[model samples]
Target: MSPGDEHDSFGGVGGSGQTRTRLPEGNSGDVYGGARRPVRSSRSLLAVVGVVVLLVAAIAFANRGGGDPADAAGTSPRKGAPAGDPTAATGVRPVKAKTGTIPTGYAHDEQGAQSAASNYAVALGSDGMFTAGPREDIVRATHDPAVADDLVKRLDASYSADFLTSIGLDENGTAPSGLTFVSRTVPVGAKVLDYTETSATVEVWCTGLLGLAGAGSTKPVTSAWFTLTEKLTWTGGDWRITSSSQTEGPTPVNGDNRASMADEIAAAVEGYGGFTYAR
Candidate 1:
């Protein structure tokens, strides 16, 4: 790092999924990893990449439907009072099937919109977004027929060779031989930001895990929170993402526990299947 270059740390702390990077002062090097130099000027890189978490991409499931789970219309609360079920599962699976790990098909109603947004948040923030093959498929699944091609091209450019290297990944976005590249999003909750018969805007609050996990890995796996806003439309018998964006925070203070060793963290991530998340 040069003396004149400014060091600004960009991070997100939400309900569970994102990455936060800190660039220390005093002749310290890049924020991404060890001695590898940044591929572009720090400011331009940050502005262009939006720190991956905010990388302007959308994720969607394949279209498949059998029995759609529509939200049963119910009376609203008397004026001035608010009403909602922020966290609860219907004991019903929202989608009939999945494409790879991505779920497919959703009802054309408010509940389904919330479910789609929450699940897509997970896929968009997943490790798959870093690699080429899966990235293309993910965008395809984003399923906005009008924009899929453009999105694929834009995403390819975003996760470029230099960007991958800065984060200690290879051309294929694979972590160094022994390290496990981890990126997963856990949606804390979802809200119907806006709704219409054929379209809806939903916000998914997430706490995500990201980075390389293994001994001697500079980018040790870390977790943070952020919210993803997805605009979706009911198309081809399912809900598809039309567009999306992200923002940091509603963050909480750090906990007292010390940071875990790289190996320990990796083990926990592997051994634990994870907690059940409700709609």
Candidate 2:
């Protein structure tokens, strides 16, 4: 109900089951018989609130079993690679440059794999991918060239106008005027489960923010926990992502914090930029 009280809605992308039918472009009154409808009664409002709380709890519980998926038995590659001692000279700095503001130059060894996985998570969760130019840079920097090419086409198709409108954002992922949309990935920890000279796999556990800030907003910024599993390979002397996947969180309960106003929330996002998370 308030700005900072977004703990319940922050990470959710859609209402459980709400649909809206469109009216013809210039059809005044055709949409709803040109009549205003009565607001929900107090009892109905109470029931809705109760159901929302229950749904949030259910979602939190459901996201806990986050290891590998059921179908990953044979399809997923084997976990962590055989132990091989790696020293700093070559392995330590495979990918360590800035492709602009974004991190690039991922190594082609174990450490490289870990760095690639973590940074890739950041790129995947970023606001940049909502727009065209930065989105392409992200894909090219994080993924293998071949994969990047294919993904760019698919990503362009995926972030279409309809998709943007459905999620309360414009085609570029910007919220409406006076609104601030938030999306980011913060890496909490990472581990290299398996690795070889040319390819490696790493898992990163991350927390993220996904929501919109604005007055009278029904959706507020929320938190989510998701693990990113990345399959990477050595190419052009650095680790490049070949593929990756994400599953919902091992999410925790919300802390008791007073909610802020929508304007305040939007201002905070505008004033603060994200960090290059580590460890």
Candidate 3:
């Protein structure tokens, strides 16, 4: 698969296919060694062999229990096989500073660029994007100054009143009194496509929620997956977006879980605040 085509398997979400083991038939002695003993049936012989195998396995495990199991394969269980792989967190603390709830003051490294890209994806795809003031704030805070003004103007034009109304929002970008409009993007992971001290290109795989949540709401909330590519520059001691683009997903198959009720979804969104992701 191409680099952009990579997707998360949503590990253990789907049912596993059952596997059947074919046990050997006939006398055990025929396979193991000499003639069969006079008294024991083949079934009994097989049972004894099973027990012996179990005992041997148990002894081996006991011997191996003294050291880290992952060490046997020369890998860190916490970080996966390749230490530098981007999917694994580097254990570095994330930026503590923020400019209007969006993270800022990244480390001026590839990891920092990646963190900026992921957090920017969250801000750009958030419910805040529906409104003018917050959307402008987000773009200004995350984007490089050279393109920030132009981006804000274009985004303002794009999120028009008609567009908002079609998605079950008012001209002011608010939902009806009893309803909640939800839009949230959560980065599954990030990878650096290209990197240097001054510039980096990063891709964030994201899943999002969009639509209206309430009884009788026409646009019931649903999930979507997409990938965002951010071209970043390390400027003034922090990484900032020069430009970004999004494409439909490299999404995995959907899980079998039942969709939550509108009330449940709204409540969850209200209760959960987003995170400041770091690589």
Best by TM-score: 1
Model 3 agreement with the true structure over 9-73: per-residue lDDT tens digits: 10000011212111111111111111211111111111111010011111121122232222212
Task: Kindly give the stretch of ten consecutive residues in candidate 1 with the minimal lDDT sum.
Answer: 1-10
Model 3 residue runs over 4 Å out of place are 1-91
What TM-score fits each model?
Answer: 0.70, 0.65, 0.69
Error of 3 at 105 (Å): 0.8
Q: Candidate 1 clash total?
A: 10
| Position 174, candidate 3: lDDT | 92
Candidate 1's residue-wise lDDT over 1-279, tens digit each? 001111111121122322311111111111222222111111233443222233321110111112211211112334753344534446555566566656667766787787677666666666777778987786667556665666677668767787677667888988898787666666666778789998888876565666677898876565444567777888888888777666543333343355667787667666544322324
Over the stretch 119-199, how does candidate 2's per-residue lDDT look in tens digits? 667666666666778777876876777566666766666556765665567777677887777766666567787788987
Ranking of all candidate structures by their TM-score, best first = 1, 3, 2
lDDT of each: 0.54, 0.51, 0.56
Global local distance difference test of model 1 = 0.54
State the displacement of the C-alpha of residue 258, model 1, in Å, after optimal TM-score superposition: 3.0
RMSD to true structure for each model, in Å: 14.3, 16.9, 22.3
Candidate 3 positional error at 175, Å: 0.6
